[model samples]
Target: MNAVNDDPNGDGPHHDGPHHDDLRYVYAVCRPLAAPLAADLTGVGGVPPRQLTHAGLVALVGPVPERDFAEEPLRAHLEDLDWLSETARAHQRVIDALTSVTCPLPLRLATVFRDDSGVRAMLEDGAERFHRVLERIDGRVEWGVKVHMESEESAAPRAPADAPRPSGPGSGRDYLRRRRSQRTAQEESWQRAEAFARELHETLSQRADDSRLHAPQNTELSRAPGRNVLNAAYLVTRADSEEFVELVDRTKDEDQGTSRLRVELTGPWAAYSFTGDEKDRAE
Candidate 1:
């Protein structure tokens, strides 16, 4: 991603040196805010984010050193786990703060430009798409819901203490029977999980403006207690958030002790999943 600048002070963000120029990083875009943001909010590179308005839209940006953000250097930085994590966290901090005040169209991390002109050009190029997105997602947020089912081993029943420890031949037969029973139970659990996920998504969709189904999460990466059966996002209005939350709560209660299934709800995030593909954002 390229980066931007429009420094008021001669010594601040954008550098107009003969050999080097600092870059501007865009965080998100939205309408002119009704009120100014909190004074202390900061973003990537530890710089405070400022609004740059063009064509009646606001692009939230901040400056970063060209030495670190310019093309070659940024590619190297992206490979550094610690650097990427820290930068991503700072980027998210600004977006989170914005979500509290407005429905912002968040750009991907590392959306940069060479100068304020470049940033404005991008806004000009993407205005129509941006406007459509803004109209679709205005006054709304994204909610994530994931359903996980406990492993069969965890849900399997234990043998009764009073049951006999059978002779060798009988013990082997009993073991085989148990294995077959476990397999049957596992199959049943998977089917039940699928059914529950579909039902839940359908119910939630009626209350949401839009819905997206994501691939189930990897158990190894998520480190959750069980396998994910449903991974979905819902675009819901702020006014209906409470009722949506209550609906989830009711489902949670209904799910209690049923195959040890669990429903996890996340966010009131900026309509990240609902935004259509935005071109010219990071190019």
Candidate 2:
């Protein structure tokens, strides 16, 4: 196996040495030789991440200099919002490029290997499992489907009170009661919306090879003006992607309601959330 170690003095974020750093990190793995080299995409971060091919698999990676990524700095930087956002965006950009060309097995955040040799060893050791993962996701893409309830203000509630006033010493109890009532109503609304989302996922998943619900990121809730009820991604055959999108559009039209929770679908993307090295026989 060929080992391509990170260039110590490479023009990356943390450039400080001539001796190869054992702290290289692997981002994604795709079909060997078949995968695009690091130059294809523009606007990727952390210098130009390269590809290391082993057997029939290639790992996409960038140099993580020992200094910047040392435990203390790495931990401190991870807690910084701007740093995390940029890192995530850069990572996604790489994933996007690879997925556009071929099925890629995306590594979770913070997946760092000791060195290029370590990366190659992993590809070689896990060659069979990796092939199986590729087989399952080959010719397929992932699509994100989210259902959210419109803002309560936008979907004006029928019941309204002038204002809330504390009655007596039992004001705390009254507050709790009001909060409970509000929660109950919200829960009911969310349950209904979730049911619809599940039905939509079921219909589409039956036609898809795989489907999974990702934990709703708080950013989704903060950015969206509505309450996000479901966050899901479906691994669909390229041939069926268009049809699946059409189905989602059609379902949205059919399920029009006063509280009209919205179902938003995005992507003919690489199946990042579905494939993994480990296999669940029951799956």
Candidate 3:
């Protein structure tokens, strides 16, 4: 959905095209921050972010130019990988700052508005879910866990690395037997890897307050060493971070049956995956 200027307060026809006036770029929502933000912190467009309060919640916003951030221009800019990467980095930096200070409900990337009035409207509209989600995530952090199985070619067991390939099928009967045996072994290894992933996710879920099973990331995109078997997020209390991390680390065993398991863990971050209500986030 387009996150363009939605001036609900009859603020004239929505300002179209590039204009001199600046739009508000929202980063996150949270209860009133107790500590002050770092003086040097900057958000998208290199603009300093400030808080705007409404309905007992604070929204972190910064000014962005309409020429670049307006609906038509913004959609075009999104296609530029360099632009998207820089914007994402800036966005995450702001969210990270908020995470350090309080339990922030992070908005999706490019959440923009015409002005403070539009932002306030959003806050009032989703006030109920925002409060409910805030209460649920307060003082809690998210952790990520992933499991991968090393490529079969790299983890060969039956043949030695230095073995020479046969110039031809030395014996058709023997070649067929060897091929069948290799296929069987590979199938068994894959099955074992899948079972290992399930067991580990269950174990981690038992320790976390809430868990989300995210779709496995693409190998090409993630550059993961092997097939991504599991990708999950867990919500645990701040106090339980140490134990949760330790639990996750203990299961990163390389020797789990014939399947070489590669376990990955990330976080102690804001609950990015937990409070993803698409309807509310579309704002």
Candidate 4:
């Protein structure tokens, strides 16, 4: 794969001035220039944000002291969970700002180009691919739906005392048996929840231009505060987004599950989750 180079001196224009160390590149794909860049957006190491455009797409960039994102420091930083989280959040802030006014293809974390020429080269060489992606997402936006099973204690049916108990050697064995039972019950609950999620997705997909299944995140993601079960995104036509929401609302009412399973729908966001460099991925 042709990855963006983060090395400041690699192949981009040389900057020997004081601000030379303050520049870094940020990524976005096939977005209209009119889209708003985040007011507070800064580059990799707090460099002031700037824009780089080629063809019909635009990217937000900034200058960073080369030492701040030096290869060695970057490698170590990438491994730090806190660093990763903060970077991801900043990237999202930029994406969110652009998404408000234009359909943008969001790049994953750490996509950096050396300079304007590099960005232009990528866009020029990948023009056809970019064009295709823009065509597919021209009038569309992405919406997310998640399904989750509430705590087992909240959803599981209480077993009667008469229910057969595992004849165990000690309380430990009984405890183990109960844990196993809970695990099985939780799995069953998730299965049912997933089924309803799929049905709802199918129904909405009919009205969407495209749909995709996103990889599941760990329970830690729940700390972000939302009932995201099936982490699915849809590429909906701009005109139909409101209708889609109404349809989802209706589905939620019709498929109400045991207190355990819950559904949520979010976004009319720029097709960030959907649009991307066609040469990189068809979607």
Candidate 5:
């Protein structure tokens, strides 16, 4: 793969310079190929993406502002949720484009090299590792399964007349009792949710080539209903994606009347979860 700035206006970064404002942001590495990426594919900071080759490997990278991506500055930017979200989306855009045409070994978000030569050197050093991961995911893609416990409706059958009432409007004693009951119900719901999540993960794991369990997303972050009990990713062969989708759909149907558990399936994503050693395997 030859490195050529995709920009047509002649304002892209120069291969050689100490401008203190430009650095190479790497998105992924893959075996060299004949075809080029889409003409309009851009990467971090909206810079035109290009590639750098070394030995049998090629890195997909784009220019990012050094002031915004440098080690110290990048750390600061990471603390700002808005900055991190935008940058991560940009990084994934480049990786997503590469994955459509090749099995790319995705790099972590905000992975920047001093320059093109730095990217080449890194590729040369990690050549074997990259090849191994690429081979493992060559014909596969990632899918996500999330299980949330919907808030229980308040329509359960009322207890017998002789049973003690839970509490009344806003009295002090009633408030305390309600709080205690609420805590107990929440705990029980979570316990049941965990068991359901475990079984769901196990069922899908049997159909996937690889699987990972990510930490549950916070409510604010996920905007999901009730509580998140399972956040898992599965790597399945392209040919099996349809079967996997069907299986999840069936599970959702089974939950319709028996439980508050709601299963959400998403994907055909780049194999993000399967490529890295940083993920926790579902046990």
Candidate 6:
């Protein structure tokens, strides 16, 4: 939707010129390369992403209407959940495209500048910091690991001998006792799951150059069979990825018979978790 120009005059903050004196939506910054991105890769507003280089750093940017991308208008648009989600997806698409061929320093979603000169200025000012980060993650990729507690129903059915005796009619005391036992079992199960998650994270962290633990997602978001207990990211060199995967598989297999915790590994993504922490971002 057009973010401005609700009036009839039609002189909105939106720029309507070939020069595109509008705001620039920045997707990422990376080491200088000879060629541009693929023809299919596009940025915000469905515009072809362009490259701006300064001090050996290359920024991927695209023109966006100032009416929709300026500080105030952008903040308002972000409050619209649908708009925000779609925009975030679009932002990630650009990052993904760059990630496929280069180690891009992904900007946060909706990062914008007044023009290409502003982007160039940022690159000039932060050139050393950018290069340091780029070097650190040059040959590495990120992986995500999560552990969840398996649902009780999905576990192997209890054998007849292990099943609890049902409280007969008029057996109040027995019913109360059974309820207490069930609650205790559930509490113990959750504790065990947490312990397993910590153990798994520790094991995997040893195999990675850097590691970070993110808050576990809720059931609705995770959509997994069990309660999510651990959510983490690992930075591993491309050469060591296979060994890392193998270690995860072996760890999960060993825990299968002893615990109802399941482990999941996903990645080779841009090093989002290991980009030198939140403090390193350009303001």
How do the predictions measure up, each by TM-score?
A: 0.86, 0.76, 0.86, 0.73, 0.78, 0.80
| Candidate 1 local Cα displacement, residue 192, angstroms | 0.8
lDDT of 4 by residue, 1-283 (tens): 2333232212344323325443355656745454334444444555434555667655555554555466777788899999988877777766666666667676667766555566678778877776788788887889888776677664558889899865556978779887998788767777777778788778888989888888865667566332456778899988999999898777667645553656678887767666654345743
Whole-model lDDT per candidate: 0.83, 0.72, 0.83, 0.66, 0.77, 0.77
Per-candidate clash tally: 8, 0, 0, 12, 0, 0
Clash list (residue pairs), candidate 6: none
How do all the candidates rank in terms of TM-score, highest first?
Answer: 3, 1, 6, 5, 2, 4
lDDT of 2 by residue, 54-149 (tens): 786778777666665667777988899898888788788877777777788888766777666778888888888888898889889999988888
Please list the residue runs of candidate 1 whose C-alpha ends up more than 4 Å from where it truly belongs after superposition: 1-20, 156-167, 256-258, 277-283
- Model 3 reaches what TM-score against the true structure? 0.86
lDDT of 5 by residue, 202-273 (tens): 999999999999999897777776778899999999899999999999988774443478899998888888
Q: Where in model 5 is the C-alpha error above 4 Å?
A: 1-21, 152-191, 256-258, 277-283
Whole-structure CA lDDT of model 2: 0.72
TM-score: model 6 vs. ground truth:
0.80
Candidate 3, overall lDDT?
0.83
Order of candidate numbers by lDDT, starting with the best: 1, 3, 5, 6, 2, 4
The total of clashing pairs for model 5 equals 0
By TM-score, how accurate is candidate 5? 0.78
